[model samples]
Target: MAETTTDSVLVTESVAKYDGAETARKQPPPEKPADVRRRSLVIVSFWLIVLCLGLPIWWQTTTIYRAKLPLDDMLDWAEGRACRPVFPLRISVEANDLQQQEAQNLLRLTQHALDDLNDFSGHHLRLQLSPPGRQNESAEIEDTSALTIRLLPGDSPASALHPYSSILDITYPPNSVPTQTSSSSALATYIAGQLRSTFAEEQAIISYLLSTTSFSNEQRPQGLTPEAAESLAKRTTRSLKYSPTYHLTFSLFTGGHQPSSWDIEAAVDEFMRPVLDVLTPIHNFTIDTQIQLYAAPSVQSQVLNKEDLSSFVNAAEWPLSPSIGGAPTVNFIAYIGNQTIGLPPTDQDASDGALATSQSWLVPQWGTVYLLPLPEDTTHVSVLTLKQPLLTFTSHLLSLLGTPQSGSLPLRLSTLSRIRSADLLLRASSTLGSLARLSLALPSISIPSSVADGVAKTMAHLRLACDTLGTPEALYHARVAEQEAERAFFEKSMVGQLYFPDEHKIAVYLPLLGPVGVPLVMGLLNELKAWRKRRREALEKGKAKKDT
Candidate 1:
């Protein structure tokens, strides 16, 4: 009985120990919900602070502001759909000696003939009969006609152009007049042929210009000879780009101080004024003359060859700086020297004097320098002495302005206006095309609102320019269009941000995003895992109780 009691005591002690341990395990670990809640609140508050404060600052720093642009409208203007240039040249027929009915019939026949002969549809000549009262004073009448065809009775039909006026004098017999019922006449054919010959150079130049540009190639003249085309290309390339105003700078360049002063002002007024007055319709010119002493040609040889002509102008020393305005500068230099131009000594004409000539030569678009051999003591050039040089300079200036080599000054100036308008229109179109291409090529380029504004202005002006093309006002509108197109295409901000590459963007964004993203992501993951563990523990406990 004693042994059994001792065993019961041992068993009771073991049961007490087991029960104490079970009670300790079931106490739920002091209920630390406050700590967990505080920790979660801290983590969420940190994330909220970062999200509210950091992201906005990064976006504000890195964001690019893109401005709206009117690219489509600009492109439309550039495509030649906005405007079509037309030149309706009015030619008055002064037939004071003919009856009104005869004159009308002749005019109608001539119009038909001219229309048949014309290949270029852009330039058309409209024929009109001058009133008897204005026939005699047709030379003074500037507004109605570009040219007047004066019909006089003669033995055989012959034509002579008036030297001082835009008059084509045609001597035709009285029988040459067209009959009322006739659709064609010898007189009409003669008149058409005369008109074509007179305007042949202008037409060729215009045709060549059209061929060289982006205008439809199929419409270009196919009859232009290779030599003629080459010559035209050279002339066009040498000429200054069209502008409403042009600055003419007459400079006297001398190797020594002997010939310093020249009567250029008086000389230009005398020799160049008439030509300038005629050219006024197309280009407004400003004249400024200067004399540069101690200026030497690039070549020191006594004789100049064709190769030396390129380096003849002392570009470094000459003060032929372009005028400070919108217009381009045309320099005319009169260099005082004794150097002669000749073919270089070769196998054929090595010692022949026939190969050599005067040293003066034209420097394409820059100017012409006449090597005048004067007395060492002479300091001033008289107006009479300057007459030849000034005249030569004037001719060179005409060529540089792309004036037609044929035709009178009035006709050349008119043609120049047409050519200039065409050139500016093409240039503006090309600029717009380039801008469109650029925008397409560089996707990251940020276009500014200024570009958009400029494009809109360009398109509007281009439309006006195109509509008024071949008219005097076309030049004004074309200038505006070109300026605006250039401004839009070369907007400063568009290219500013292009140099910043994608690698640079990544480098800029990685630092702030990488550091800040890590803590937020980890905190969310930890919260999710804890919630899943708690739900699983509750489910297992319910299952265990059910099984029991």
Candidate 2:
């Protein structure tokens, strides 16, 4: 029984009977040449379509677009190679007491002396004779001049600056007027010296700015002292950045319940209004006032120190919100408190040049704070009591605007314009350089057409500003250039398409192409091998037939 079961398991196939001719295996008939050619053509066509159509479409979809930019010109401007700032200051000369010919002669001689004395190429003083009581070209030049020299017949030669305007009052001897035949005059030399003194600080500051920036040694100011450079550095750090408009917030902060009301409007009108009017040509100011009760300083000691002033502002508690519409705000605070500021031993005379007084101290780039010691029961602050603080504020405002300390108020204001122009020009150039570098470093970042347009406008306005450095128009153009450069550098759409990880790309593309590509490739390879085998068989058969 066991042998029968094993034999049944071993019987896997049934036996078949066939004739002798059927025992020989036979091959299928050979494929026709047309069919062989058709298979090759199909494989080639499919591969050609994939290579020509699919690859190009994929590349076009993934490419990023970049707008053309003036990169070379932008870099040139940034490195101070494209434009050298030059200030052409028109100076009008007038002498009502002298004849017109004498006035002309005096101006010519003074100009010669000035040319000999000036070494800086950036600032040029062009002397023009103002026609007496005539509304013509000379009058127009007078209106545009940076300064006016008014000559008067006097016992001796002396120059005095007009406190209210940009006029240099020069009194000279009667015989000091130059003749057309004379090459020089004592009055001309005296006037030249006065002019040099007037613009000395302005020239130094501009030179300091250039030398510290990207300018070459030749373009730098001829003589800049360490003391002057240090002073300029302090002023630069202390000043607020350039802005077309500044909001002035006059706030009265109190620790007690008293002094709820103040005559801030009347005080500003009486003391600070004139300075604001003078600065109107270069800057615009909007004034507002507020009172905050129970406001305390960050430092609560009865006596405050110099170090305490740095953190005096309770930033979290103060209602000193910034101004809107893209303009900066400057704060002036009068704190009614019993605490007195204790100056260090070395800073006893801080009021002289340190921008601090016994009762007040200036916060760099922010504003000024005055510790006003008032009676505990006082309810209203009078304008009379605010006279000194307001005056202090007026002076501090000029400092905050980066005004030179050595010049008179009018001359300082005029210098303010030139300083601001240079500052804006340099800032715009730096912005352009940064943008260029950013584009170079990031090959994949998209550059929008608006950025290119902004760069174009910036360079154009920068050129205009460089051509008219000393004029008011230069300031306007510089402001525009700076704004445009910033806009170009900060364009919102410059970030390109979202990033796709390599792992994710592989995951997506492998699944898509694996099914379609693998079969095509394997089929073509197998067809090539089979064709070679067929050729070998045909050659072997032909050789055998020849032998027969």
Candidate 3:
């Protein structure tokens, strides 16, 4: 057994020796110069291709798409430097009772008084004497006149605005008319005061807009007192942004199965259609009504406080999604509950008439809510019952659309168009500015070509709107600019990839590149070293032969 074991060990050693010798014998001889040169050339070619072609392809594929924009111009628009809004109102003066010379003199004095009283340069009233013969053609002249002044001699100086027209009628004593040489007169001052009072709301609104934006102090009007500014701010905040259309939603929310249905369609048609028809020139309306049963309010107190009104809408469970379109939704919710808002003094309620009322409350930029207390057995709400609520909704709707509080329906709608145009213009400019600042702050963020196109379109439309303000076309252009600017600022590609860091990109690429790059680089380096040594040796040999 010992001999056999020894034989096995000897056999293993002999086999290992034979295998080693066989492998050594099979090994090829050292490479020739041509073979070595070919190998070096192949490695060099591979490295050159990688550096020159592969690297460029990789860089091109991984690079972000950056589009050029007029950053400076966009910033200028945002800062209110590019466009200075000016409202040139032409007030026509009619003095059929007085001579041409007297009318012209009165007009000059009133205009001077107006200029002295005016603190805002952007909004100015220019008085023009209507041609004496144009009195019969007042309809033709009405198109041009922002306001018309009709003078009549009376016992005392008193002024009244024509409720139906933008006409101010003043009964002045004969002595109140300005003489040819008189620098100032009571009649002129009275007219100026009336004009200021007539435009008080408009002036306050425009001033509020300027003050809210980044307009320079020089551009804003000075007459906005803190109290007035506060009031205007509330009104502005209460109003929704300008839109071509608005979705009117009439919803009946009930805590129980009773009062589940309402005649909302008839109520809207009867009480709201006239107002909607009048608003057609400035805005369009789409109506939809729904009945939600077993609905609960967020707050259940019998006497809801001021804060409770804000949370009354059960937003989580309520189907109050905005209409699936560009237009914003105005929700008119009629909740069936006995909850009453705690009463405040007359002064407190006056400041917040919409929200403090027991009948209904208006939610800023959202909609109105009416708490309806019904009998336990009541199931269907009649059109008559819905009348008061619908009327309340109509009045609040006007406020939501930013209509002038004081004016005939026609005049208010006209003012709405102009106000909306200016609002959209300023909003678009502000958005452009925001986008410009964002781009500057984030240099690495990739701005896609679509964003550039949108920006270009916005600026072009903005210019057109700025030049044609107060006209319907201006509102169209302003809307386009606002839409385009919003689109550019919210570009999905730009926003989604804006925060991706360089470290993340490197981490993603390292695994694929490390194994391949090291081998290729080391092979090239070794070949270069060998070639350099061979060249140096050849140079030394040549020198030795020459010396010999």
Candidate 4:
């Protein structure tokens, strides 16, 4: 009983001790709910402010503005889908004495024959019959027809091409005319042969052009030989790329200051006006003539060999800079000197036979320079004296513009237009393809709205140019298209912003994120520890009460 009582006393003391401890703990220690709420509110408010205001402002300040581009349309324009060029040449027939039915039959048969003979579908010749007895209708016909076929009854069959005019004179017996029922006739066959021969060079050139370009091989003539292809390639490479206008600079370069001036204006008007007038459809030329004295070539050897030809220009000393405008410059230089060209002879005596002749050379797209030996004291050149040089320049200009060497001036100029159009179309397309590849290659490059705007403008202009190709207006639109495409593809800002590296971005972000994140994370960890301690104390008090 005594031990039990002793145990009871001990138990009672322990209980008393526990009660005292419980009462001391139940004093409800600081009731930090307000502090907890205040701390949470501080954090929550800070995060809310950062997310609502700071993040958006940061994004707005750092984000790049991207604009939409019409990439597909641009690619299509470059691929030749936007334009398929066609040349429809008009040919008028003048049959003064033939009856209406006979003339119509001839026309039908000629059309069939010409179509059968024509391999180049791009340049189709259409025949139109002029009313009989029309006076000097040749002048009126010249305005519309590329060429006029004049038929006259004679004793025998013969044909002649009228110089200075595009007239094909064919004399035939009156009985040779086809009847309405006839499918073919001798006159028709003769005309077809004549027409084919006339346009043979043009057909070869056009076929060669189609083959060299991105145009499908199915449309190109398969008959072009390797030699022909090589020649065409040379011609195309030698020619200047197309522009709306061409600046022709006529320079008279002399080693000495004897002939300071020439009647170049008068000479050009006399010798070159006709050709210029003919070429006006393909290119607008601006002529500026100047006399440059004391211009010495790099090689001053008495005899010039093949190597001397290249260094003769003295590009460093010559004032042959391209003109300020967008048009290309063609330089025509008449270098007055006594230096002889030492060309290697094909035969042993060919150089000796040609020693006395003046040396003239064509400088690709630049121009021609004719080395003329003149009297030492002559001060002025007559128009007659300037004739050969001017004529050479005219030929060089034609060659530089890629005109066919074997055709009428009108026909060559027409061909030049077609070639230039194809060149420009391909150039624009290639530029577009490059831009597309660039965009694909660089993901971070910011494409500005201006680039998109330029791309759209380029595509629109390209479409217009393609639609109007082979016309006078096509050049204008093509020029615009080319300029716009260049601008779009080479947009400055696209490349300008590429200098900043990814490392720099990471460096910039690290400072702010590092400092701010540490404090917020530590504060949340301390709050969690305090909450766990309070819950453990409450659970132990409940267990002690249940045991008592």
Candidate 5:
């Protein structure tokens, strides 16, 4: 009986301990209506502030700044719809010996023939008859006139471009002159044929440029054959882009200590100055020469083949950096070595005369490399010895500048200006188009106000260039357009912002929002539950009171 009583006492103690624990763990009384409403207001206010003010402020602070761009206008410029390139060449005909009426008739017939022969409408040739006995034809004619034609009566029909002037001198037989009643004349045909041949290279270059672009079929010239186009493509690739100035570097590299110096300054003054002066109207050149002794070439062969010639330049070891300005550099290297170029079996004999051994080779648009063989004891290169090399460099320079091969120096320079203008205009247009396409393809990229400004400036310059296509001012405007387009296309801010991703945004928002949002949402739910219970209890009490 005593043992049972002790067990009952222990059980009572355990039950008492459980009762105390339950009483301590019980929830407090339900919240009052005013308190519930206050908590709800607090939660709602927090969410309202976050949704309306904080989020907007955060978005505005973190968002990229994008200026408005004229995408439609940019696309139009790129598609060749904004501008049409037209090269209007004015040719003046001078017939001092013939009557004024005769010269006018000759000019009219030649103009008709040229028009019929020309398949490319973008490049038009208009001929004008000069007054009789007009002295100093070149000085009197405006800069707009590309070429002047002089008609002289002679025994045989012959046509030749004047070596010093942009004038074509033609000698026609007396019988070749067309009578007043004649519908067509032999003289007119000869003049048209001559003019066509003279501008053939220019036409081919322009047509090739159009073919490479996104030009429509109507704009493209009809006569470019596949082979012709391929050849033109090669030439275009080999030439450098047009620039206002070129840094001309003359480097003399030698394998040994001997022949360490050269009279390059004297040689340039004697032979190259004249050509540079002629090219001044189109381009300016800055010259600096250096002598590098004990310098090794990339290839170590005594007899270099055509394949070896290409790799002879050691670009890594050479100090041929371009000038500081926006001008491009042209390197002319004269390496003193005894290496001979290996000729093919057909050219093995010197007596063949058909294939002469070349001492130098042109490296496309880069420059010329002359393998000048000097005596082992020689310490210096004389100005006389450098004459040949300088002359070769001059010829190569002309080719590098994209000068037409079959004309006088003056005529070629004029042609070069026109070609450069056309090339730059197309290049700028293409750049603008590329930028437009890039912007369209990459929507996340930021476009700054500076980029928009540059695009606007480019378009303005491009329009100016188009209006004055054949003049020097046109070249200047095209150059500016090209620069501005390049600047806008490669804007630094746009590129820098492209790498940021959405993952970073999620990482930033989750940490701050998670903690604050969870408690506010739970508190609001609990408050609503208490308010609903209170309303139900009040309704029950009201019903009981009515029954009583």
Candidate 6:
């Protein structure tokens, strides 16, 4: 009985404790509509800040601002569709001895013959008769006339080009003169043939240039001989890239210490100054001279072969640094040594007659090296001794500047201007094409307004250059176009910006966006799930009421 009573008391105590614990549990009131709506509004407000304000701010800071460009017109210039180059050469005829009517007839007949002979349409030689006493107007004629043909009577019909000026002296027999009634004469035919021969090389070179470019079929030059084509190709390759200014470095390099000084300044002033003065209107030159003693060549040969010429320059030790400007440097080295050029190995016993005439070798696109076999004990090279080398350097300079070999000095210089203009025009066009292709190739690259401006300037100047293809202005405009196009194409900021790829953007933004995005997303999702549950419960309750 006592055990049962104890057990009942224990159970009563345990049950009382459990009932007290259950009564002690607290339950808050149900959430009001106003509170729940306020919570949802807070969530929406946060989302609205992110969607409307935050995203725009982020985009504004990170977006790439690219200026628009005239891509199609640029492409047209690049592909040679915008302009075709045509150079009309005007030749003035001075017939002081002939009557005006007779001179006009001869000019007409010669032009007809020239037209029949000329196959290159891009180049035309139009003859104009200078008024009788107007021939003394040297300034005006020099500016306009490409060449002046002076008619002089002689024992036989002959034509000779003036060595110093752009004059072609033609002597015609008294009977060979064309009459007003005659349709043709031997003098006219002779003049036409002579003119054709005079410009034949220029025509071939221009034709080759056209043929090699994106020129259409009609503009291509016809009947270029294989020999002429080969010669032009060599000439083009041998010439240095054109610049408005050139830095000529006259260096006297000697392996020994004996010949340490030279009279280079006097020699240059005598041999090179005249040509430079004549070329002043086209190109500018700045000269400097140096003497290098104890200078060893890269090739340790007593006698140099044609093969040794390639590796002759001691590039590692030579201080042949380019001048401190945009102008290109040309090194004229007078190496004082007893070394001579050996004939080819294929001809062991052949006469060294042809090789003896040339103590120097031309280094294409660089400069010339004249091997002066001075006495071992001699210390100075006089102005007389440098005459041959200076003359050789001058000749090489002309060749390096792409002067045509066949024409007279004045005519060659004129032709060089035209050639250089054409070259620059083509270079600028090619650069534009490359830039266009590059823009297409890299879409993510940022284009600045400066780049667009440069491109616009390039195209503008390019159009002008194309219009004035044969004139000096063509060269000026082409140079400007080239410079601007290169600047635009090689924009450092654009090239640097190209590397900031999409992957880098993601990496940069991931830390900030990743953490902020997850919490906002999860909270919105939880709110949505709770709202869906509430809607389902309300629908079930409405169904149950309808059933009742």
Model 2 misplacement above 4 A: 1-46, 133-142, 178-182, 344-355, 495-548
How well is each residue in 392-476 modelled by candidate 3, as lDDT tens digits? 9999999888888986565566667778888888999999999999998887789999999999999999999988875667889
Local accuracy of candidate 6 as per-residue lDDT tens digits, 1-548: 99999999999999999998887765566678898889889899999999999999988987777778877887777667887878888999999899988899999999999999998888889999999997668557857888888899899988899888888999988789888889877889999999999988788778888877765566567888888788788778778888889999988889988787889999989988999999887789998888888889989888877667767788788788586587889888888887877754344221321112257766778887788988888988999999999998888899889888987999999998888788888788888888887788878788888999999999999999988878888889988998999899889888897667789878988998889999999989998997898789889999999999
After superposition, candidate 6 runs with Cα above 4 Å error = 1-32, 181-185, 215-227, 344-357
lDDT of 2 at 348: 39
Estimate, for each residue in 1-548, the C-alpha lDDT of model 2 and write its tens digit.
99998877666322222333355445457798999899989988888888999889988996767899888988888888888888888888777788888887888888899999998888889998776864344435435888888887899999888776677889999987777899878888889999999998888889888878765566667677898899788889889999999999999999988899999999999999999998998999988899999998899998877667777889899898587577888889999999887875457334323355688888878899998999899999999999988998988888898888765677788788899999999999989988988888777777888999999999999999999899888899999999999988878777433343357768988998899989988988988898899889999999999999
What are the root-mean-square deviations of the candidates from the true structure over C-alphas? 6.6, 5.8, 6.6, 7.1, 4.7, 5.1
Clashing pairs in 1: none
Give the lDDT of residue 418 in candidate 3.
70
Instruction: Report residue 157 deviation for candidate 2 (angstroms).
Output: 1.6
- Select the stronger candidate by TM-score from 1 and 5: 5
3 or 4, greater by TM-score:
3
Which pairs, if any, clash in model 5? none
Error of 6 at 139 (Å): 5.4
The regions of model 1 sitting more than 4 angstroms off are 1-67, 136-141, 216-225, 317-327, 343-359, 518-548
Whole-model lDDT, candidate 5? Answer: 0.83
For 1-548, candidate 1 gives per-residue lDDT tens digits of 99999999999999999999999988877437788788779888887887898779867875666666555754554554544445677888888888899989898999999999998876788898888978557656545467888888898899998766788899998777778888789989999999999988877776776677555544455677899898787677667766678888888888887676888899999999888988877778988888788887889998777666677777787778686586778877777887877753342222211122253555555556676777778889999988888888788778778887777666667668777777777788778877876776777777777887777787777778777766777777878888888888777777676687889978987896787688788988898787688779889999999999
TM-score of each: 0.82, 0.83, 0.85, 0.78, 0.88, 0.88
Worst 10 residues of 2 by lDDT: 12-21
- What's the residue-level lDDT of 542 in candidate 3? 100
Q: How far in Å is the alpha carbon of 97 misplaced in model 1?
A: 2.3
Candidate 4 local Cα displacement, residue 189, angstroms: 3.2
